[model samples]
Target: MSDRHIQFQTLSDLYDDVLPADEREAVRRHLQSCEACALEYRRLGDTLKLCREYAGLSLPLDGLNDRTMSKIRSARTRRLVLRSLPAMAASVLVIVGVGLFSTGTVFVRDRATVAGSRLSYSDSERVIDIIRKHNATISQVTGEYVEGTVPVSSFNDLKKSMGFRRVAYMMVDESMPDENVHWGDAIEEVGHDTGQPVRDWAPLTGTGASRQYVRFRVFR
Candidate 1:
């Protein structure tokens, strides 16, 4: 092959200057005639010269190698913790399950008995009667005391029977006497004079029957 062809073909290999002496001489001869090969040789020479200049200059160290190694270790530890978390949680669940199985007798027994037992037939009847009486009392008390649309004469009789010191209808916001009234309803009924919604509000039955409010606030 011609010197030009040989040099072009082998320029990459010869760039390292590792070629045999004969091959290097051939490449030099080729570069003298071949413009393209000559240009390649000059470019390689420039790159080598630049590399040599930079080689003498020290690369800066900002402790990056140690920091990078620390980050890698941290990442590895995190991965290990993440991988083990499910197993740790599962072990805790198993321990809890064993404890529950050992100590849960009373809880399980109460649950089972409550689920299985029915009240005796006579007890059921007594319960029904008590509930009915309680409901009736509640209805009567709520009906008698809830404010609105009573005859004036009846109102006076009611006030006397209930032993109120004074009784008078007054325009008051429904929410003033009872916060349970919706704001919209209270605003709508703003101007109407009515008795306080339940001045003597009291539970009429249940364990609450002996409640102090019944004696002091209501009956008295």
Candidate 2:
């Protein structure tokens, strides 16, 4: 057989010890005659002996494993508590805020009559009645019912005339053919024309037969 074939069979038998006695004897005979096979056998034996020696030695400890595990557990607990604190605080804040808001609403509802008593007779009238009494003219244009400029002027007059502590404006846009043109848009347009900011004129909703209306508040 070739030297390569002999080396392969010899290494296989040396590692497994599975070759028959006759074959083992033949490989041993060939190893004794072949210097290359003897050198390989010696090198494999030395490597295995070194591995066994290293395996028998005890590995050194750095004390990091136990400390790291303890730190991890501590950090996990801290993270869990930190995460829970915000939710707990948020729940408390929400509960307190809701309680305060509810209390304020109840207080307002209880004192509504007392608050209304402070206002004058004309001031207490519904905005639509106030608008009509002030001789505020109304016109229908482009299928939209537009209140005349009198509402704005009368509102000023009512504030001065009745000593109306707070005068508010009520506008109804009863556009039968179109609902898209909202009161807010009208208020904004009016505000722009009046050289006042839209937000400065507090615009609220009013009921209409077929369209929407905006109500402006005059508060003392």
Candidate 3:
């Protein structure tokens, strides 16, 4: 009933599981009597949970950081240009619209798809380890596919280390819409579409490389 509320740092610490046990318990007890703080706490948890779920992704239903790293890498290739080019869309809030047309690279904003039947089932642990080293999150893994997001800057490293092919990629931008995409589905589709084997493919830079996710899907 005290109009006093807990501070933001306390709530953040609690969410991160970093607060001392006594402070955590005190916060919980306060939540029992306080509606507003509890609601805020729930919302924070929900948002982070949804973000984590963003990694186990699939197609156009698409959609860091060691976050400072993300900004640095994302800035490397991703340029946000608002210009009046010939026949440009009137509503060009677009950042990654034009791609290397000479290579016939089809552009889908904010996604990078990788695939390989060559991805050995035996390297499951190695794959996980590499992803882990990159500070990426693995959202889901079934026998057919391993799905997750990695730092775009480091994506090339991941591609080379693992034999998993870096078949195709597009820029990741904040302005993109959220869709319900998944890794398993993307690999199957891209492989069929591009017809490139694992060895023949080039590495992904996410060159428009966003950090928190240069999402990857590899066939297991």
Q: Rank the candidates by TM-score, best first.
A: 2, 1, 3
Q: Write the per-residue lDDT of candidate 2 for residues 133-215, one digit (tens) a residue.
A: 66443222111112322433344443333232333344544222234434443442223323332334343334455333333
lDDT of 1 by residue, 1-220 (tens): 3542554447867887788899788777777887877787778789879989999898898899999999999998887566446534543453454344345532555644543343333332332233223211111111012222122223333333433222223222211323432324212111122454434422122132222111111110
TM-score for each predicted model, relative to the true structure: 0.34, 0.34, 0.32
For each predicted model, how many residue pairs clash, with residues at least 3 apart or on different chains? 0, 3, 13
Could you give candidate 3's per-residue lDDT for residues 108-203 as a string of tens digits?
343333223323334555666676676555644543455565556676666656553332333344334326333242242233323444443443
The regions of model 1 sitting more than 4 angstroms off are: 1-10, 17-43, 103-220
- The Cα error of candidate 1 at residue 220, in Å, is 75
Per-residue lDDT of 20 in model 2: 80
For candidate 1, report its TM-score. Answer: 0.34
Candidate 2 pairs with clashing backbones: 167-218, 168-218, 169-216
- Candidate 1 residue 63 C-alpha distance from true site, Å: 1.6
Cα error of candidate 3 at position 133, Å: 1.5
- The better candidate by TM-score, 1 or 3, is 1
**Alpha carbon lDDT of residue 75, candidate 2?**
90
